[model samples]
Target: MLDFINRVLGRESGGSKEIAKERLRLVLVHDRASVSPQLLQALKTDLIQVISKYMDIDEKAMEVTLDSNERQVALVASIPVKSMKRATRTPAVSI
Candidate 1:
């Protein structure tokens, strides 16, 4: 994809070697960050809860993905905004 983009932009292709190097760079980033897919999912869930307090959100539409290079991992998340509404009123009961 990078090569194709470079070519389309009239830039020299980095070639397979450059592509491999780039992959390694990303992997290293991921490794150093310690952000794996599982971690990202947990982070996404927490984020949704925190953000939901102020606004509505579609939990199903939430996205938490990870990309890794040779030694690095990157965490990416996408959450859509939703309308906020109060739930039905309930009568209080003594414990």
Candidate 2:
């Protein structure tokens, strides 16, 4: 609603510029990695699901990104966990 008005006014509609910039970054990263944006999204979704099984996460706040330097590439995940589950202990079996 408000975004429509901002667009009408020839303004960057409600932080859409930021969204566009981030999307562009994602595209660049994926292009360099030879992966499609859809593949990146699929990986992010899977990461969220797998991580959520062990923690209470703020799913909306999570971010997964690929970055590259002159020599190497990195896959980074920023997951905001509300609470992390403790590891369950098991007794050692005697021989």
Candidate 3:
């Protein structure tokens, strides 16, 4: 009832609690997945390799974790990029 009243009055009710609930939900889902730790680590390694093929990234600082809401699951990866290869511009050919 209080939440409904707050909503009607255009006030946010307990945003931090909601955020914490969502984060807890994600951690629970990740913890509950059936894959072995070794396999998950392998997957994370593969992710780093694939991403590093395109950009110079902070490999030592990368982190990969799983997350899920009620209906969807995701492999969340935090990769810090140190630098990116710039594309060289070709001289424009005038017709």
**Per-residue lDDT for 1-95 in model 3, tens only?**
99999999999878899889888886688678865668778988898888776678997898877877667888788989999746354547899
**Local distance difference test, per candidate?**
0.74, 0.80, 0.80
Better of 2 and 3 by TM-score: 3
TM per candidate comes to 0.43, 0.58, 0.59
In angstroms, the error of model 2 at 92 is 9.7
Return the lDDT, model 3, position 77: 84
User: How accurate locally is residue 90 in candidate 3, as Cα lDDT from 0 to 100?
Assistant: 52
lDDT, candidate 3, at 26? 68
- Local distance difference test, candidate 3: 0.80
* Model 2, span 1-95: residue lDDT tens: 88788888887756768989878876777687897768879998998888876787998898887876567778988989899767453446789
Each model's Cα RMSD: 8.2, 7.1, 7.7
User: Which candidate tops TM-score?
Assistant: 3
Could you tell me the lDDT of residue 86 within candidate 2?
75
Two-way lDDT contest, 1 vs 3, winner: 3
- Clash pairs, candidate 2, are none
Clashes of 3: 0
Task: Flag the better candidate by TM-score, 1 or 3.
Answer: 3
